[model samples]
Target chain A: MNRQFLLNLRRGFLVTVCFFVLLGIAYPLAVTGIGQAFFSSQANGSLTKNGSTLIGQQWNGPKWFQGRPDADDPMATGGTNLGPRSKTLVKDVKEQIALLKKERITPTPDLVTTSGSGVDADIAPVDAYAQVNAVAKARGLSVAAVRHLVSTQIHPAQFGFLGSPYVDVLQLNEALRTLR
Target chain B: MGFTWTIVAMIVVLAIAWRFLGAYMVSVYEGRTRWLSYIERPIYKIAGIDPDAEQSWQRYGASLIIFSGVMLLVGYMLLRLQGHLPLNPQHLPDVGPALSWNTIVSFVTNTNWQSYSGETTMSYLSQMGTLALQNFLSAAVGIAVAVALIRGFARKNSKTIGNFWVDVIRTTLYILLPIAFIVAIIFIAQGAIQTLAGPAHIHDLLNGVRQTIPRGPVASQETIKQLGTNGGGFFNANGAMPFENPTGLTNFLSMALILCIPVSLTYVFGKMVGHIRQGAAVLAVMVIIFGSWLAIGAVAEHQANPAVAAAGLSHQPTGNMEGKEVRFGDTSSAFYNITSTQTSTGSVDSANDSYTPMGGFAAMTGMMLGEVSPGGVGSGLYTILLFAIITVFIGGLMVGRTPEYLGKKIQAREVKLAAFGVLVMPITVLILTAVAVSVHAGRAGPLNAGPHGFSEILYTFTSVTNNNGSAFAGLSSNTAFYNIIETVGLLLGRFAIMVPVLALAGGLAAKNVVPASLGTFRTDKPMFIGLLIGVIMVVGALTFFPAVSLGPIVEQLSHGKFF
Candidate 1:
């Protein structure tokens, strides 16, 4: 009985080791290699550089369109769970609205609402459009020119239905920089 | 509005998948998928696993433990060595020893309780290679064990259950692979990122600040993570992250994937035991409990945070929007939170810690109910079966007769095994929670104190020991102390219960089926289902009530009254 148990144990151990090498080491390496070979852009973090600076730019400058109000930590990703009834949430939104009004831009609801992931890369169409004038004026550009550009940047709701239509804020901002 | 539609769509998709997937699995386990033998034939040959050669329960149990032990060591080594490996575009360091120990045991035990954030701590190689590989293997292991238990009930006067290796291989090839592959493709199509890319460095010309956007092979990892009920996310924000979930379609799809196999396994159980009604009965009980918790979470979350109310914000229209993704909305987030916890998938779309005190309670209690409200893939069915046996034993004692389940007499040995399997989780969770609170290290972790603090500590032990993997998010669990204690919780909670369950299968397989008489209890009847649920609830409630009282229960009462 002991011998049979031992034999099964040994075989089990051997199979585990073999499968580990096959799956744990070989499989992911192959997938990673293939991903890099074919989709190098995506496989390497989809990095798009403007001069030397990375995105996630502070939008305090009027030339930039803000994405969402995320926490200060770059690595951290999650929303402020301050409920609708939260005085803190109300205060934050109130402060944001006052600031946006000071810049002479109408703040959209999406601008004030915290995103599910704090570091949301996209903003609502209304939010983006609201900032067009501010951005155009900052760069001494025509509103029509900036509006056309923003419209081009809007990625339609995924497959046209999954999520709301929005534009990538960094990409839009990058486009603004290149505009004459 | 999107939340309501998503819920309806999710129900419709699950209802369809349950019938087809359930029926498909019946054939897969019955060895009827010969069309795939071309692939599996070489695999069986290399592994030296004879598909037809069944082993007795002792050998089967030994085989499982040995394989898990070996894989556990392999997983540990891989995590430790990931810093030197390729595909680490971020140059993330090797995992610290204690964290590595915690992580390996978490994944190996099928718990996937992540103390560290995936995007920061792990290389792409660690995520896809060791963690994702175990997601498939651990889930397959669970299904294999579950099938063995069913075989025990199906056969008469037989010492053998089934071949563990054959069961594991076939489950992976036939059930998990096809579903995960299709879902992974769908995720990619829906904009969930599949990349080998390093973290993105996009220049925001306006802000003058550099922000590094993390990227990874998210969609591929996500599919199996949910499908296998292994809840560890490639990103720390988990399914809530845009790169991971992306849209409502992916969200609905993920919840469905988390539920599909476990729900279908009920049909597999019924078909194997020659009674489809029995499977339906069990599934009904699971759905009832799960739906109740989901509803409770939604209502509680929508009621507004009282502390927020006292602070003077009123006229809220979207309900409690705090700590939730606006894209998913409050109702959907609440549903997802409850669904994830109840199913033991542990992948959260919303932070559970930020939930209203009662909302958090609803999620935690789902795990405390032994997570059998259609639990994680195989664990759900087997745990419920254990409950069924206890129910029968109780029913027998009340009526003065030897209890029987699926024709096998419910002898003392079987009853003891069932009791052990059911009681082990609660005991571990309670004891561990006690130890954690008593020690300075344990009390030191929670971000908040008072009852809410207690809830965080209690939730960790319950989540880890149950192999559920979701966290309250308020606990600072990355320390050496948490890593070690939670490692113990995951290992003991998984293997300790599994050992007795296999023994129970062996014991049942050896017994002859007794012919049904007037005194025999009908387990498939509605009355029996109620009794089984009653037994499950009573046991769960009685065992963990004190902990609940100390945590969410008191926290809820203390809300507005004190806070």
Candidate 2:
């Protein structure tokens, strides 16, 4: 048993080192090489002209179509883990609604509530359409044209039955730049 | 409709893959995947292990513990020295003492309950080297141990189970790595990012404001993160983060990855034991419990969040949206979170803390059921088998002398070991929870007040004790007190249970098989499945019932109308 114990230690040390290199170093580097080689844009975070279409950003004014209300800070992507019974959550939602009331068009639930990742990149189509009037009013473009732009930017669920159909706010705002 | 389809899609995918994956895994463990054993041979040469060596249970357990201990130290030191390590583009500083200890234990045990956010805390090297490496090894550890236990049943009066070194290496090289590689690239193609670059600094072209979006080798880490049931996130938001999970398609695929190994492991269990029905019985128990929990989670999240409703909006038709993504909506988020918790993969697409009281209950209770409804890859099969042993013992009590399962007699020693294995989780949970809630430090952990606050404390202990890494997230768990307590829980949760399981495996493997008789309690039948489920549910609910009432249950009764 004593000799077996000693042998176990030796094997453990050598095996641990062998695996750390094989799995830790070699595997990730190999995957990264493939990612950079082929899916360069997506692998590099799908970085669009407006920043990565994956991360939500703060929009200061109506010149841009706003993302979710509490969408800010990518330093640590997190959510307001407020309970459904949390008064703090209620107060925050009410404040968000008040903020949305001041904007043009209708407000949706997703616009009023924060996303699981505080940096959500997408919002429902209705939420985007709600911001069309404000974007049009701020840019001095016709609301019809701004709505058309929002419509064009909408991405349906992949493969018809996968995810929710929505629009990426960053991509939409970048597209809105082309409108007269 | 989306909810119904999501369930159907998940069930269909798992049903298609579980059998083939199970058969393939059996081959990997049984050493039939020799085509690339050229790769395995060199690893054995380096590790000084013989490919043909088999171990008694003690030797196998000793090797397993020693390997984990050395790796624990190595991982701990890596995190401490991460600031000075290469590939640290963010140049993050060393992890503090408490968090480092907490994190090493968490990863090494495959619990992956992150006390710190990933994008902020981990360097690229640390993410790739220490944490992600543990993701592979720890999961392999689980599969290895599980295969050893299955050997306990498969062999008759066998002194030796399989070799620890060979089982782990083969499982990783043949099963985990090959599958993870494919999944990682697919994840990248589906928009889950995989790059060596640091957090990207890009300006919003529309607004001219700069934001530093976090980036890493996320796709690689993520594939195993779900596939191995490790649940450690590359970012704080975990699966919710777009770069980590990407689209809804990726979301569905992630759930499939999490379920495939664990779900298929039942078939492996069946195939190894020489009777397909025996394994199929286990699979049925898992399916029933998993399906029931899925229903609860989906239905609970489908209801309009009371707080969201009380806040009053003209258009509040969509179900609970707080702490959930636009793409996942409510039902899909609940589906992902439930799948995660049910299997000891605590990764979340939505925040558990933000769910309706009942939705939160479903996720939390899944872990309280000991995560055996198609649990973690290796852990779940062994855990359910322990319950099976206990069930046979009960049957033995009723039927006079014989209480054999698959011809293995349920002696006193076997019964005690099984009881010891099953009891440790609840005992750890109760003790730590008692410590946390009574102390000021534990009291400070919750982010909300009243019942919700109480739920956070209970959830922390429950999650840690079960080694299910998903948190209520509302818990401020990074404190020295929690850091220390959680470490204790993770160790006791994983190893304490693991040692007894290995011992039980040894005992069973050493025993002579008694001939099957009419008096024997059958494990392969629907009746045995029902008994096994009853034992798990009763034990879980009875143990945690008092504590649970203070949290989600009470909050639900109050209709989320309480403070």
Candidate 3:
């Protein structure tokens, strides 16, 4: 029994050391080598650049768009963690509505509601039409023209089949930048 | 197609390479053991010092703490030296002092909550020496704890548990290393780049300009990354970039690799505990939860918006393809989301922020539920055990008997520890979310409108507290305020749960293993399995139901066509 225990102990120790050396050390080294050789940009965080100025990676979304009204930092991707009845959220929504009206852009359902981090609200897509009218009236344009712009500019579905018709805030803002 | 084949080939080669590596270690160790014993035959070695001795909870805990502390210091120093380090062709900026502290703590804690992007911030030396080393050690720590727990169940009145250093080393070498090696080879063949120099060169057709892509040793990190379920990426783009994931097949394979060890460990649990049924029950619960989330995400992806349909765009029969890699399609992307969320591996091929509200809800809930559906390496098993303890406690309560789990009595102390382990994350998340929404720093981040924007804030807190590093990628988390709060959340989220778990293990170690009787609840039975699943869901529901209904459910009702 004593001999057996010793043997098992020695075996376990040897196995453990060898395993770490290979997997922990060698494995990572080997993989890093491959990543460096082939897919260089991605291997190095997919960083983008323009004349020596480093921009964000293409994979990460930019935060300068109209922004999700639910959370504070629109540039950082995450949820608000607030409930629908949250007074703070309601106040923010009102402010957002006022801001959208000021910008002369109609708000989509996705634009007004809380998502992911467990807050709910009672805004619907129909609200978009109301916002469009509000924007049109403010812009001195016809409601139909406002509606047409909103519908045309929103992000269409994947191959046309996934998600509600909505505008990507970033794209819209980019277009606005060009308009400016 | 080329990408897909390359990925598949990578998976196969990784598996084979790991297996061979394991075999080699086993042989090498066996030979070493023979020589050591031959030398020690005349002298009696204390069992405590003996590598062969069964592990005790005390020793295991001590070793784990010491080893982790050393690694933390080492990783911190590496970060400090990066600006001056060699192999830094880009002359990348040095890591700031505060951020360096945060990074060290994050990696050591296995949180991998990165404040800085990889390619832009870290040099090659920093990546390999600090970040990569921590990846190995942190994962090794998880494996060590798991082995200790398994040994607790396996042993009877043992004075010593396993050697923490030995377990960490062996697990990394035998399990993680071999697998990683094989996977790296396959990844290389499949189109994953492996090199020691600058990034790949690509010419832009639109601008007729040449760009130098950043480069590093990615295959090595990617292997343990997924295997250990530590989600920090070599590049800030994570798995989404073509190099990191590369193709549809590689995506699937990487996803599988991330989940494989955690999933298989259930079988290992059963093997260790001498009960396959018990393992199956745990696995079944995990599969059920995973499957439900996948189905929800897939359907949500498949159901394109009415506006898009009106505009003549349609999602393929497979599902929604927006914000997803076309190479992998909906099926694979949806699967990736579920797997990554379930295992606490945060790598993503699609933009999670772009997922439909309902799909987003499922992903958030997956993380919020403590991610115990076969969670992170070592961490997952320990957490599942916590669930098991709770399940048995509730079972005991139902039958008006004293709670017992795996032959040990589940006393108040154990229950408290388990509860603390489970509840801490939610409490931290809720508190932080409340503070963020109520305060200026927190409220200043959203880029969307109204409740959905609020959900983004809440999701950030949830993901951070749960130690699942994937973000909605829609929030602006680069500010000083976010950096501080998130680092705090990550630290507490990891240590708070870990401390309790280790304490519970020690508590279990002290209890005498009770003999089984017919009246004793058979943990392996179907009824017990149902009870376990129920306990998990109920705890989740009770804790998150109100918050969830308020977010996704309300948002969907308000915005969804059916509503």
> How far does residue B147 in candidate 1 sit from its true spot (Å)?
0.7
Q: Candidate 2 lDDT, tens digit per residue, B1-563?
A: 66667778888888887778889888888777797877889988887899897888888899999999998899999999999889999999999999999999999999999999888899998998899998999999999999999999988888998899999888888889998999899999989998887888887656878888888899999999998999999999999999998898899999999999998988898899899889899999999999999889988988887887888863456688899999888888998999999999999998899998999999989999988998998999999999999888887787677588888887889899989999999999989999988889889889998898988988888888788899989889999999999989899989988899899888888888787876667788888999999999999989999989988989989953747
- iRMSD (1 decimal) for each model: 4.2, 1.3, 11.2
- Candidate 2 colliding pairs, count: 1
Kindly list the per-residue Cα lDDT of model 2 for residues A1-180, writing each as its tens digit.
789778878888888788778889999999999999999999999887778888888888878888897657888689999998889888988888788788654668898889898999899998988888787888899988988888998888777767788898888877777767
Model 1 agreement with the true structure over B257-303: per-residue lDDT tens digits: 99889999998899999999989899888988888888899888787
lDDT of 3 by residue, B153-194 (tens): 665665555666566555655566556777777666555555
Off by over 4 Å in 3: A1-180, B1-50, B53-55, B204-207, B305-319, B560-563
> Which of candidates 1 and 2 is the stronger one according to lDDT?
2
In order, what is each prediction's RMSD in angstroms? Answer: 3.8, 1.4, 10.8
Error of 1 at B425 (Å): 1.1
Worst 10 residues of 3 chain B by lDDT: B39-48
